[model samples]
Target: MTASLPVATQQDGTYPRPQLMRGAWHPLDGQWDFAFRDDPREAPAGVDFDDTIVVPFPPESPASGIGDTGYHLVAWYRRRVTAEDIADAGAAGTGARVMIRFGAVDWAADVWVNGTHLGSHTGGQTPFSIDATDVLDRDGDNELVVRAVDDPHDVAVLRGKQDWLEEPHAIWYHRTTGIWQPVWLEVVPETHVESLAWSSDVPNGSVTLELTLDARPADELDATVELRIAGELLARTNVRLLDRTTEITLHLARQRNGQQYEHLLWNPETPRLIDATITLGRGASEVDAVSSYLGLRSVQATDRRFLLNGRPLYLRSVLAQNYWPESHLAAPDAAALRREVQLILDLGFNAARVHQKAEDPRFLYWADRLGLMIWGETASAYEFSERAIAALTTEWMALVRRDRSHPSIVAWVPLNESWGVQHIASDARQQAFSRSISDLTRSLDGSRPVISNDGWEHAGSDIWTVHDYEADPEILAHRYGSTAAITELFDGFGPAGRRISVGQQDGGQPVMLTEFGGVSYIDQDVEGAWGYSSASDAQDFARRVGGIVGAVRAATPLAGFCYTQLTDTGQETNGLVRADRSPKIPIEDLRRIIAGD
Candidate 1:
């Protein structure tokens, strides 16, 4: 297994955005005064303080010190930011702005500083920032207040696996109400780089960088771009920033031959990253600078196989729920996030279908460093309505804008199990919605394939997939054994008694057993513990797992496969590892089977 690169710093000072690194930032992830109120007050000016809860952990989790599972339609949080903290963030100087960024706040959130209302954001999952430069009291304590509202029964909202009931049941788990991720402060110049996007052309050995600036430049500014590998400078160029957005392409020096490309191209075997440094300058003095990295690779779904760098690479993947017994959606710590990536590689999988939730960026960073492919997925809204469409489209697109720079994300799964468009099989409007989303995803980023709706009843997809829990190896092999059977299965019913192809499918696209082999195993029976197929003991567990995975590997028409899950989340016990992350059997035994040896 490839060792994961150590996180650069601890949680208190961890750089949340690893690809784009800045030196001036301060984390706001400690104790905060919290209270539950769905009252008439818009802000928390006169509200009484009741309890203290940890930042970045929702009130539902035990880690937050308040394990409230009931419906709290509205929640309030307040914290005092000292002048020292602002100065430490480097935002107190002239022409510098202090931006308070929230990793995420559920449903909707309204922010206020010193009793002045800044604004409100609607998306629950995506990150947001507010400039507190004007309202912040630089010499004294600045009271920052936030009001969060996450309606427990709002099915129109994209609530991934968060169960709405009082207790978790079936596939759903506990709710993560408010502030489940980090909050931090950063200082930036008036004209600074906002974000960057990279696109690599492997055949030409050139990478194009699209840079977005914070504001329009009053005068023409010059910028210098540098690319390095292993601390060795590979390419350096100068670009003129006449507009707020600019593009520059750099042709790498040593990627002229197949052998050189093999050594430097990003793959699970050789995950080479070219470090980048961008400096914005006004004549001679440096205005702003930041550090980032890029991975030169390409992915496509073509000719019945998933291609990585124009080569057929079979995807040995597991469905990563990315949940924990303690932290629900958030990682217990930075180290635990790294361990999750390492454990996936140790189990002999090259890719992961990060199911449901749009995962933390830190997890994506580890995957990029350790060379694991990811099928990026987003949470889904259960009901089909105008509100659901607007909510899902807005947040899902924002998620794409935020995460498109990560090289480890090879594909995008906008919806799963036909969650939002449940009636796509028969309804035309839902079917149209599914197709439009797939088209939109392709339009935004054409570098990778997009699965419109996973599982059966696909409206449109680049690679056709199916979810079958057929435990018998012989039956499973025969089901996907022949090309004729494989071709016919798409036009007919699938294992779930739903049509494999509904609206549209590319004739030459890849066909993979993306999801299967969910055989539940445990020491003994516990309430609500179940699987499609059960194993009685260790011997049976190994046999069932080995047989199911081997069956998929032996099937000639199958290009790839993803096992049921990576970990046992909530009530689901079909994971390869236990909920506490203990190996049900020896790790090596499972690795051998998963690797098809």
Candidate 2:
């Protein structure tokens, strides 16, 4: 036996960070005994294999130690854990509860812990969590089994850009399935804070906090939520809404912290957040408490400019696809995610459009911690309708519920370039469907901005988003200068030309070159064209692409720009790095142009 596989080491390699911790109970994500079975029903009884792979990282990814291979269809992962790992998690003296968390699993996954079958989940994108306090063995090792069936090639299920074709062609995309995220168990107190959500009505001079708590119904607990600035109380409220959902409002008077106030606000330049504490008490006896963070920033359109913290914040952003060559859609490790984010920040960009796929929860978690704004998006194929719409809407709503609290996410993009919409249909039906989905997203999350269709067609959206591919810079500078504030510039192929029919000004609006600079692919092993067309190569990939990026940077009229990609996917070599994560161009070179160095 290879001893019990070791737990995952944090960046510092000292303590274990639970997949997502609320209090004391930490999750077991580092090691799991696994077996690749031809069929799902044939999974063995216990941790009975020498072959061990790290949990969370997909088996196909190089980081998982399984190396790169397309062999898995249905694989099983098993491990044994102890209850003692989560005994004292909440604050210090609070009662404990254990919960299981999955960062993400592709297609579907079936979980069984301690011989009791838990349940299954579909959809390759969002994260899921479950309470496992009941099945935990206090003094003995408990069993954990996961049956992962990923059809990375499945055409029917929402596979995003993952192509079923063995040889990726056109814009079909790379395949990533199975447990692509970390899985662990968390311990919490009997009466404790489950999660903290914040909404800043900056113009209203107030911030509202929605607190979700998990505790026993019989216990009558006094809850006091306090918001402080620089170690002094700014707003304190005692509420009796324990044992159920509760809302607390804190109004600011001159931005003071009970004593002396500072006029400091959160912005892209200096993203400021306050540390808050939730205290649960029975009269004077403090039963439980938890620590949380929140940012006071707002993203919206004002006088034809996107404002951040009441200033016209120009977003020189890029479309970043979180995929490493050896790992595919998975990052080599959490540090890799941080490194990429830092690269963007170092480039002097304020935001990233997390294009196509829903990134790892930890990625978003760090985005919040590091203060990078995001245009969170979902993956859609070249199809559309009520069924697809329903699925997309359901998944997006769940995504918002899980990630809305994060300060990094500023916008939600449901459809991109009509990837999943049937564009062949009449414009009326297309517009109606597009508008419907956009409206649905708005109704669900009214706090952040929503982009209906990211490319040529503007069915309806809060931002006049576009994607342009024109080589000439003058077209955007002078051709279309009098339009809505949300104009998006694509390869000029979709609706811009048609929308400006019969001699009308194309009002440049807040001209954002949403898509451009797909400089083509030139990896020795893989040869392919850029997604939309064929106009680039490996020899000239960097210079040609860098020329375009530099051109956009020099063009001051453009509000923002999003290069076609951050990393290359299979067959698509336009990324700054090769599909396997090897940098195509030197980092210092890209940094020079990105940072205007």
Alpha-carbon TM-score of each model against the true structure: 0.96, 0.84
The residue-level lDDT of candidate 2 at 451 comes to 72
How many residue pairs collide in each prediction?
0, 24
Off by over 4 Å in 1: 1-13
Residues 1-40 of candidate 2 have per-residue lDDT tens digits of 0112121112221122212233344556677787766565
State the lDDT of candidate 1 residue by residue for 480-565, as single tens digits.
98998888888799998888888676578887887888889988555699877999988999999999899889888888999998
User: Could you tell me how far off, in angstroms, the CA of residue 284 lies in candidate 2 after the best superposition?
Assistant: 3.4
Q: Which stretches of candidate 2 lie over 4 Å from their true place?
A: 1-23, 37-50, 68-73, 88-95, 171-173, 215-219, 229-232, 254-263, 385-387, 424-430, 472-509, 521-543, 550-557, 577-592, 595-597
Q: What lDDT score goes with residue 4 in model 2?
A: 20
- The candidate that achieves the highest TM-score relative to the unseen native structure: 1
RMSD of 2: 5.7
lDDT value for candidate 1? 0.85
What's the CA error at residue 112 for candidate 1, in Å? 1.0
Steric clash pairs (candidate 1): none
